[model samples]
Target: MGCPLVSIIVPVYNAERFLNETLNSIKSQTYNNLEVLVINDSSSDNSVEIIEKFVKSDFRFRYFYNTTNQGVSHSTNVGLSQCKGEYITFHDHDDVMLPSKISSCVEILENNTELDGVITIAEYISEDGSPLGTKTALPDYITNNPFFVRAFERSYIPTWAMFMRRDIINKLEFDDNIKIGNQDADFFLRLLYRRPQLYYLSNPQNRFRQVSKSLSKKSTSTCEIYKKHNDVDIAKLYTQAGYSKVVIDYALAKANLWRENIESALNYIISAHERISEFDEEEKDNVYFIYATCLYLNQLFEPCLEILQKIEGKSFRAETLNNQGVCWAIFGDLTKARDYFESALSILPEYIDPKNNLFALNASESMPVRHFTKFPLRSVYKTI
Candidate 1:
């Protein structure tokens, strides 16, 4: 069979620093039947000049500039409306596509006619292009569950990791109003409602640059798209579409927690606990951590400690210890708190939570003590 054409939609903002490397990586992809739709969102930097250079030298690279600074969702939709490839994917202007990424995904789609799309794993990179590590592993149930179930758990499928048939473009568009930095997650969740079949490929790796000030981390509210769908409750819509109840609750809890809606977060997490038995050990630990966090925020220290103590796996053990230390400190047992903080540091020397807690403990000798509180969300720790 002849090679199928692939279209890559790249949304550019002020990405001049990494734009050249990003485009070069695409140009060097092993798969050659490709069209690059570089949508420039009126970048203030010299990103437009760099894009023009690639367009001039390569037949496959095409550039389109927005008249004004529309956000990523609008730019992505523009590329979606114009792209003519048999297969399509999205890329960020600052991230790199590994050499075999396109070819690997296309090969699987060609061979497995049942899969509507494929998602590959990614490695995290520093701004200087230093490799940090692989992104967190997906839950083990990803392969067998509906794509939305996995998407609900953590929104694992970013635009950069996803490759799909052009048909998906006709069914969905990026929500132009989703400004909370989870536009990709909103798009994927809506797509999952359509029940598209997808596969996760572990072999091909993409480089996802972890910007410290990325919008997702800095944005406090959940995406607007999740608030309503035709005025129907989003959770109700997903439930009608047959998504797992536990995952849906857990996801809502996380969203509410991000907005600091501690009461709502606690409510959703309690709902999740009704079917907590369905979760695997690690997944259960995730729910427990969120539950404990909500309790901690509500100042239910003893209940939070009880839940934190049930989490046994090493993945969250250190954070649990750090949180327990915070509870002890709040209860005015400085010695016990110090011991817990010290134990947490022993387990994870580089962990910032315990280190900060220990410092606070030491500083409290004469000055008024100010204790730090830790809330573990998946792999990230939020200290307050």
Candidate 2:
């Protein structure tokens, strides 16, 4: 039998810089039966001409342009409306799909009758097309967890990395209301609510281009997504899935912290503490660190120090010590703060934060020592 047709949706908006490379990557796909839908969201640049070049050359490539500059979600919805294929996936105009991406994802869906979708890990690329590094997702862990649970952890799966049955569009569509960012998160969360059995391949099938204007820079939208889902219904869903309420609350706290809403972050972390038993040792340490950081940021130094004293794990030992030092300095004890900073340095001599703090401490005997609270605790949790 011939290969089943696969529809790839390309949403373009002033992406002339990367349009040729993106379309070329799609054209080179190993899977021949493809319907490439290029939706131009009113590009003021030469993106339309670049898109037209492909449309004129290839019968499989179809181009559509929006009159007004609709958002990515709207352009994607328009592509979804027109695509007719056995499998479909979204491709950002600025990103490049590996030549075998379509073939690889289709092979999995073709073989796994029980799976409704396939998502692969993605390799991150710089704006100049050089390899920056991979994302924070550990393939073994992320694949084991439910997509719904993993959605709250961190964004690893880009739109181009996911391939699904065409029928999913029949049931779900992009939320055009997500104006700023987190469009993929909101859409995937809604998709996970229907409980689609998805397969996550360890091998990366796309290169996600990271530019200055990428949506990941928008922290306010991330805060909005977390707040929008902090209700009892979302919490209950996680609990039913065997994840604890603490998970949701901690995520909200982290989200609020990103946007520098210290009071809200502190409140959410405090709420997370109410069911802290649900977390394992590592997760507990993460929560404790965030709790302390929130308190420290909110001027509740006493309780923050108390929380810091309770952390017994080596996971955040350096960060905890540095924060404790800052608290001491704020309390008018420069000597004690210096000792704590030295302790952190002894534990991690190469650590940047504590080194900076220690240097600042030695420079002055004044209060308010330089504090460093960069905690990369997002991917630390194992699938629970």
Candidate 3:
């Protein structure tokens, strides 16, 4: 059989600044049998012009423009409808695919007929293409297990790094209603529900650009609303899939925590704790961490530390230590807080939460007590 054709769908908005680089990355893909679809969602910038130029220059490049400003999901759906290849993938207009991205994934999927899709790691890049860090779609343990647990807890495979068969793509559609992000997670969970064989490549072949204007960075109420909506749907799906209720509760608790709905978060964490027998040691530790986080948020510092004391594992030691520092900071024990933050940093030097907390703590000590009150525990604490 010949190499299957791959269709790369890119959703563009006001991405004129980096659109050319993104297009050039796709053009340079080692995989030659590919069609590039740039769907412009009524961009106010020169995005459409750049896309048109690429289309004119490359026969494999196709351009589509929305009449009105639709969201990324809508633009992606439109591109999905236009794709004519056997295998498919997606890209963001502001990101660039490594030259080997398409070929690497294509080879894996082509070799493994059972796999419905293949996912690769992504390298986080700054606006100017400088390296920020790297992230994997799934954690090491979850990746080794290759089970529903990974899908339930963190189904955050970036669209840019995923390659799916057209048949799978035909069976799925991005929920345009999920306006506040997590659309990719929701889609991934639904797709994984079908129990399709999947593979993960640890090689970082996609450069995910992190910008202040990205949907994830938006903290508006509208974004929160959509995030909660999507989270509710995902939670329900997980419950229906007959996964452990503790995991489900933990997921809901984390979602509520993100929305700052302390009451709901507390309730979910309580449920997870009450059914602690249903979880493994690692999961139980995670539950304890979340429970402590909820307690810390509610200003129950002593009880938060109590829960942290119950947690027993190195898996979440850094985060748990960071939370302990936050609790100590709130209890007017800056010395203890500093010690905890230092301990957390010793555990994970690259962990940003403890570093931020340490910085905030030092700032508070240098400033007047009244001025320090402005930097509340909430501001210093990272979410679970």
Which is the leading candidate under lDDT? 2
What ranges in model 2 sit over 4 Å off?
Answer: 136-147, 153-156, 215-220, 244-278, 309-329, 332-381
Q: Rank the candidates by TM-score, best first.
A: 1, 2, 3
Question: Model 3: residues >4 Å from true position, as ranges?
Answer: 136-149, 178-180, 219-268, 274-280, 297-299, 341-384
Clash count of each predicted structure: 0, 0, 0
Local lDDT at 186 for model 1: 73
| Alpha-carbon local distance difference test for all models | 0.77, 0.77, 0.73
What TM value does model 1 have?
A: 0.83
Tell me the RMSD of model 2 versus the true structure. 4.2
**Which parts of model 1 are misplaced by more than 4 Å?**
136-142, 178-180, 211-220, 223-261, 271-280, 362-384
Query: In candidate 3, what are the lDDT values of residues 184-244, reduced to their tens digit?
Result: 7667656765655667677788888998787656433422432534556756666665656
Query: How high is the lDDT of residue 197 in model 3?
Result: 60
Per-residue lDDT, model 1, residue 97, is: 89
- Candidate 2 backbone collisions, by pair: none
Candidate 1 lDDT, 1-384, residue by residue in tens? 459999999989888889999999999999999999999988899999999999999999989889898788889988998898999999988888899988888888898787788877788899888998886555322243343544544544677878999886575888777543778767876776666777766654689898875545644135354453332355665566566777778777876775566798899999997789988877788888889888888878899989888998786677888888888887888889889889988988888878877887787744323343334434531110
- What are the clashing pairs of model 1? none
